[model samples]
Structure formats: C-alpha cells, structure tokens
Target: GAGVSQSPRYKVAKRGQDVALRCDPISGHVSLFWYQQALGQGPEFLTYFQNEAQLDKSGLPSDRFFAERPEGSVSTLKIQRTQQEDSAVYLCAVQRGFGYTFGSGTRLTVV
Candidate 1:
C-alpha cells in the first residue's frame, strides 16, 4: 500500500451487530495504531502495534473491542456488540517521525 486506506468509509450497524474495520498502511511502516473520534472531540487512542506485535492495548475501552496487525502491513479493528457509545470514526494511523499519517477512517453508526 502506498498510503493509508480504510474500507467501507461508512458503516451502519444494529445495536447488537459486530463490525470490522480495516486499514492498510504504507508498505514499510512499523509503528502505531487505531483511534476513535467522536463528534466535537479529539481522537482517542485505541491500540498500538509495532510490526506484527501488539505492544500496548491499554487504551481499548472494553473487552468487546479488539485490534490486530497481522504481518504488519495491514490491520483490523473489530467491535463486538455495537452500542450507541461506539458510534464514531475509527482511524488507522502509522507513526511517521513525530507525526502520524491517518487514514480516512470508518464511520460507524449504530441504530
């Protein structure tokens, strides 16, 4: 992947449905992770991955939220048992020096 790409830019899930958001980072990136952004608020850290290893996931809000970066090129964020509070944009980013390159994000709406 040449740049960060997120799939199904918009997602609508039912109250109990599960959803998986995908992110493909640049070919050689080896640091950092996911963020959840609510309207009128800053992005909140969800997890971090160094290559294929998940070094830190303390930011994940609950057991129902899971993330993985298999093989280190792409990543997936899975949300189980969707709730109204889970409605937000899930962003995938890679560490680039002191800054980050973020994907367009997947907007999840629970109805």
Candidate 2:
C-alpha cells in the first residue's frame, strides 16, 4: 500500500476473547510503532520496531499485549484475553523524515 494500512477498522470482542490487529506500513519505512488511544486522550506508545527487531516494548501495558514485525514491512498487535480496559483505538504508524504517518486505526470494543 502507498500508506499505512490497518485492518478491521472496528471490532467488537467478547470478554476474554483474543484479537489480532494488523498493520501494513508504507514500503521502505523501517521504524514502526503501535499506540493505544482512549477516547479524548492522546495516543499512548505501546511498542516500537526497527525493521524486524523489537527495540522497545516498555510502553506496553501488560503481558497480554504483544506486537511483532517479523518481516519488517508488516506488523501485528495481538491482545490475549480481551478485557473491558483493553478497548481502545489501536494505531499503527511509521516514522518518516521527521514525523510519522499513521493508519486510521482499529477501534476495539471489549464487552
């Protein structure tokens, strides 16, 4: 894709269900990041991947949240045992020259 792409723009998950969000970044962009954004709040950093290596995951809220970019061009943010607090907009972004290009995001609603 020409820009960052995220799948399942909206999702409704049952409590304890697992969900996997996908992100396809622009070609040639190496730095990728995942963020969780709650309503009316700023995006909170979740994880960062430089190419195929995950360099920073300290921002991840818990062990239930995991992110990977195995092939470097695409990434996934997976949530195991979804809970009410896990509901948020999952945003995928790629670093550009001095900024970032973000996907529209996946809105997850855990019930």
Candidate 3:
C-alpha cells in the first residue's frame, strides 16, 4: 500500500497569482482531508471528502481556496489570487480508523 504523497514539497508564488498543489493518498483509503498549517500553529482543517463526495468544506479560509477529489483518490488544492497571508504548509491526510496519515506538504511562499 502506498502512503500519502505530495509533490514539490515547496512552492513560491507571486501575489495575485494562482497555484496548484497535488496529493496522492494511500491506495484503498476511502477518506481524505486537507489542512492548512501556518507557522507556529496547528493544522486547521480545510476540507474533507469520502470517496468522490466532498462531505465538508466549511474550513476553507476563503473563496480563493478550492479543492477537489473527483476520482476519489487523488486530490488537489488550488489557490487563486494568492496572498502573502496564504504562505503556509498545505497538508493532505488520509483517514484510517482513529488516526490519519499525512503528507510532507507543499510549503507555499507568496512574495
């Protein structure tokens, strides 16, 4: 079984630009989640999905953030009009019972 993996592991974006971060979750996992972690802070849940259904997205910070798991396995987070405040680690995790397996994350830097 493959563990969750994220690409780039880092990103730098100019203000007002857009960026896309990718995540590949563990095979056979049915639940996935996205979270944003700011420096010196805990991860804040951004969105969640079960299979192909987006069950919750209330934690998305703003309209600039969008996420999707169209095929129920791979997921992506897109940020539009990136801002300096959006510079943070975007983490993807897959649920397994009481625990979750997380990716290293894409560290976005907006300058």
lDDT of each: 0.90, 0.93, 0.92
**Per-residue alpha-carbon lDDT of candidate 1 for residues 50-107, written as tens digits (9 for 90 to 100):** 9999999999999999998889888999999999999999988898679788888999
Provide C-alpha RMSD values for all models, in order: 1.6, 1.3, 1.5
Best by TM-score: 2
Candidate 2, backbone clash total? 0
Better of 1 and 3 by TM-score: 3
Q: What's model 3's TM-score?
A: 0.95
Candidate 3 C-alpha lDDT tens digits along 1-111 = 149999879999999999999999757679999999999999999999999899999999999999998999999999999999999999999988897889999999999
Quote each prediction's TM-score: 0.94, 0.96, 0.95
Better structure of 2 and 3 per TM-score = 2
- True-structure lDDT of candidate 2: 0.93
Clashing pairs in 1: none
lDDT of 1 at 50: 93
Q: Give candidate 3's whole-model lDDT.
A: 0.92
Model 2 per-residue lDDT tens digits across residues 1-56 = 24899998999999999999999986768899999999899999999999999999
